[model samples]
Target: MSRVRNGLIGRGLIPVWLLLPIVALFAVGYVLPLSQLVLKSLQSEGSWSLKSYLEIAHSPTFFWIVLRTLTLAATVTLICLLVAYPLAYMIARCSPRVASLMLLVVTLPYLTSVLIRTYGWIVLLGPSGPINKTLLQLGVISEPLQMVFNAAGVYIGMVQVQLPLMVFPLYAALARVNPSLTKAAQSLGSPPTDAFLRVTLPASMPGLVSGCTLVFLSCLGFYITPELLGGPDDYLIAQGISLRVLILGNFSDAAAQSSLLLLAVIMIFLVFRRRIAEELDDSSRFDDISPLGATASGLAARRPIVERASLLSHHVGLRIHEALTSVRRPLLRFFAGLALLLLTLPFAVVIPLAFSDAPYLTFPPPGYSLRWFSRLFSNTQWLDALSFSLRWAGLSALLSVAVGVPAAFALVRHRFPGRLAIYLLLISPLIVPHVVMAVSLFFALAGTSLIGSPLAFALGYAIIGAPYAVVVTIAGLKRFDRTLERAATSLGANQITILRTVTLPLLLPTLASAAIFAFIVGFDDVVFGLFLSGPNATPLPMRMWDNIRLEISPQIAVVAVMFLAVLAILGLLRLFVGAAIEGRRSQAKT
Candidate 1:
């Protein structure tokens, strides 16, 4: 026990010493407001009662809201799965170069803020927008479609935003499949369709399940897209809970709604547990990769004319992969051309539009100028909000990493009691909608000094962000060999020195990944920002919310574009860095 303690002390296992500013900041911002939230919820009108919970249970509107939220979440998940599966499967089966390009195209949208990305859908789906204009020009419609502020708009935005979540897991799962298994089945006299059905599909089920779980989990907590795109009557549980707490100040009712929503989501996860577990298992029969006496080329050559035509109908996918990967520069150029049109155009439009002189949105503005950009800077409210956001993000990111690194190490290196439970608790923030958490927090911390402070807000946001850091960091740690640390120790290095020279260097990539994730979580946050932030602590997202609600300001668009650009740059950097590290590791193995 003494040696263990001494070893830990020597290794820098001691917790980080919180700076005076951070401690003061957290106390005022997080701890105080949270306490107030709980006190307010429980001691309403000077008496503690179950009346608030009972009132929420009795409300018909709450039940309907809950149902609508779940329905929207489930629908979005279904759509993401349907669209993402084929894309994921194609990418997985393609050559490495092609697969990488396809994955990049699919995930690029994920780099943008949800608000900005959802706004793109708003423009596309709005009445008299391009879609309507195009249809009219083609003589296919007599009038502009009423697409925005409807379920259709909601579906479009949600599916587009969540598609990557579905695609990523499915792609990972599909990539793990042994290519030869399908070929072997085909050689045993099964038809190609039957071979894939009986072999490839079942083998890739884990990725499909993981993707579905992730998408479904994320969809349940979606606030921005649905709130922006859907009609007021189309309130989901998140919107409902947000209204109850931030707008209506009905803390108890919001808590009850949140508790129920959490329960429902947990139940859904429980139902899908076995499938998800099977998917996560590394020892499963899915990872074998040696090919059976066939290749994709061989399969294509033997296909009958009818089968060929059917395959030809799907030939665009093959061509895309080929174009993306082929040694011929022309083929690669063809793929790049398509990406420019479909993926890059929307992003390009926003950057120039931020400099528009015209008041209204247009493709080629009436003589572009830096009017909005200047206006964005001159706005004191926005400037204050921007400063607040930066400070909160920087502080929250630091604190989250501080807590997250140790927890990740503990999770990766040691087995302890209730480990799984601790994991679930840590990641629960990921599954539970932020609005619901905000509500529970409002109830949980009522009457404390933490309510309405920046620290309280950051604390809540940090909790949400920490799980992502831990999960990513643990993935890095798992890939890391402990042998290097042991070797360093044997060569006369102490624990701290070994960690500094060995573990930290090895885990730096994951650490950066975690930091980026933490920043993104803080940056895109709205639900907690809405509930927790006060005038002094208002972040950029909250400020945007205020601007949108108060007036039709083009400066909001400028803010949105700048924010998106920063996030995109950061995301690209992270991606390249991660890829580089992965490449280095692979080379070392070879």
Candidate 2:
């Protein structure tokens, strides 16, 4: 038996037991559910039909909504790219310490929940909110502008939330620009501005394109932001799907919309497949020849008309070049600072409004009080939602880690046929947008009696959360030493005993990190809550989503502030506490 086991191990198949559990979970959690959804979508009146798809295709409302969603996503992508370019340039050129600090500011949007960040935008952009109040006091307008609950609010909120996604990628691209190219350009009598335009800018296109593709897809899938901030007239595709399912009970219609939307995403992804790889790859090698880019660079590097005329004209051109170069660096830093300030403003606005003693959401509080927070704690409805959200998050985290760790181990250690297929199946929940997942799971589980239960929420979230844990566990496993496991196997220990005594203990910290990530994802989720939650089983984010639409209150502001504070604590723990522990262990080892 030992010889057979060793032979299998030598063939890179010893750690294969975990593969079955992962495949089974993926089948139940994703493949079977989504397959049923696709089958239902193709059937109508107990017969296979394209009626739903045809109806949606011919409907003007569907066309208008989808077009609007695409337009918003493109606009947001452009805004993010334009804003992040200078910011990324400045950061890339800064000292490492300064860049790290600034990067933290850029990361604020990602740290807080999307639901919380969107709420912050509401308090800042509403008619009676800070932007309106400032404009009113400044006499910029005769009356307060209705910014929230409209298209403008949706645009602003989407851009703000998605900007960080753009910046970090562009910065990574810029940081990798070879300084020697710029130096060579300068050595050839080019000004700093000319050097950057000719050399540095073109090299960063990969990162910019990657960021734009990512932000476009992410914005196209907007759920809670547009719902909370957009007017009745400003529905996006995701919002429309939810309304069809929850309001009209039109699962067939919703499924058709989801299928179309998924197709659109797939097409977009196929178009930019190379650019999207920048998310994981070290650097994008832009060896593709672009006649347009080459022409533009040649044009920009060409001298002004006057400079081609005379010596005096050339002297004046040199002065102009010096002047632009002189101000360019400072200008880049200033605007970059302003853009980063906008990233922090959403959460900054939440703190004062949360403590406001005012009857409604107000900034620069007339007086400070804990009234809203007290109300947050005392309300039984809120208390119940909080309890349910926490329990579901915990259980979902456990499920995610249990499912993901095995999957990661099997993939890392095995050399089996159909390996890539299983990997893709496990990670499909992440690739498929949240709207599709929610709609498909809602209809599939609604076939059973699980739709309105907390268990439904956990299962749905676990399916999504598993991908995060899997990615993190895979990273940790790549750093793990296989020799230790082999040594244990040779010491008369079975595979399970080796994993218990050696593998699990070694990867314990990584598993904890995966659990924490799963917890955050499950807790912050609003889509599953939107589709599957009952009134009695509402999660905290769902409560926030409801209050924004049905009841306007300062209490929501309190919750947003709480989210900020709790996330800050977690960030601190992840940074400082983890570092301290690792430091102590290093010292002990030494």
Candidate 3:
């Protein structure tokens, strides 16, 4: 039996079974739909043609919307980089305690729903919101200015939604910068300003490029923020495509538009992917090919006054640097403080607003009550939507783990034909924009009479959620020690026994966290929910999207707060599980 098992394993038949689930999910949920989408885009009058593409190309509306999306995405990327760079730099420079505190502040907004974050802007910029009301009270303006439902609101919401994305990559880049290089520049008589630009800034470029690419791509497909907060004439590409599908029932036109956007995403990623992969794949690249020494030398030579004065006075050269450092540190703190406030204040304001009895959105409520929470439980539609979201979360958690765990195992424990291709295919859902994926899946599901089916939505959610699950599981597997498994095998245990008794228990903590993350990813989904969900299976996010659009209501605030609560609970659960796992690991080591 042992010989047969070893032979099967040696032949790689076990890995084939291990990978079967993910492959099947990929083929049915992703590949088939994308293929159908391409076919749909090419079909014209029941015959193959580029008529849809030509029509979309010629349409003024399409052109403006595409231009708006590109412009907005680029602007948001730039703004997020500018705002987050200082914060990231400050965090990187700070002591570990301070840095950890700052990171917690930065990460808080991420834990909250993106829908809720957009709602935060609505509360701030509304006619009856705090900013306008305060201004009116102070006689700064006689009439409330229209801040919501405009380009300003969309920009604010999108920037806030995408800010954390930019900050993390930049922080990683900045934190990894060799301090010795900067010190060497200072020693060589280069001013702090020149050293930063020539040495430190260039070193941080990888993060800037990665963050900008990610934020821009995400901004293009964003639907909830723009749809909820944007004005009638402030249409973007995703909005335009959705309107075409929802209003005119024109899947072909929407597909063509989506395909165009997809092509752009592919093109942009091709331009930057090499840099991203280079930095990620080879951590030692910076150490091997550091430009800091070269940059500092050039800049030091360029500064004649500083070079000449180095003999006259060591302190004289540092005069500019001292003054600059003294002022710059405070300015960094002040702006970072403001940015943190901007991140945290909205959530703080909204939590109380949910408890308010006010009829409309107001900062200082007329009164307080639990009516909204009651309504959340009482309203059949709300309950139904919440129920479906919970169901979606559970099934997606299961499905993601089902595929993700084995995929992680295969990728980590084995190397075989098409390994890299398989890995790329598994993560390809992330490569395309969500709106494009939604448009493609929507049409593909329609052809099979599964457009509004809950099962179809679950599969769609699994595709998106699995990538994250795989990532989390892979991270844990990399940290796992295989010695325990070998010990179990030497004790006469079979492959199944070794895996079941040793591997599975050790991986449980990471699996649990991955499952919770997968749940949240499915639960808060709006774009796919918008395209695939309907009257029968209205996910909570889709319902929230509807509520915000058809009418602004307090119930949405209730839902948002509920989202935060669920995430908080899940976060605590994961922490507790982590502690337990650590305890057991310690016992095993002893």
Candidates sorted by lDDT, best first = 3, 2, 1
**TM-score of model number 2:** 0.85
The lDDT per prediction is 0.68, 0.78, 0.80
| Candidate 3 per-residue C-alpha lDDT over 332-435 given as tens digits, one digit per residue, 9 for 90 to 100 | 88888877777786787678888999776667778999988987898898898889989877898889998999988887777688765677567667667777
- Colliding pairs, model 2: none
Q: Model 1, range 1-590, lDDT digits (tens) per residue?
A: 99998987654433222123333433543445444544444555668866766777788987787688778878888877766766777777779998888777776676566766665666667675677788999999999988889888888778878877887878877787776777786678655554565456655666777787878887887888888889988888788777877778776666555666666777877676555444223444445534442234224334434444535566664454344434534533454344324444445555666778987766445677888888878889888888887888777777777777777776566555555555555555667667766765655555677777787767777877777777777777766877767877878999779888767866777888788778778877887776677657788888777654555355666876777677668767867876876676566446
Instruction: Please provide TM-scores, in order, for all candidate models, with all chains considered together.
Output: 0.80, 0.85, 0.88
Where is model 3 more than 4 Å wrong at Cα? 1-16, 136-143, 187-195, 275-322, 447-449, 479-498
User: What is the alpha-carbon lDDT of model 3 when measured against the actual structure?
Assistant: 0.80
2 or 3: which has the higher TM-score?
A: 3
Provide the clashing-pair count of each candidate structure.
25, 0, 0
Q: Pick the candidate with the highest lDDT.
A: 3
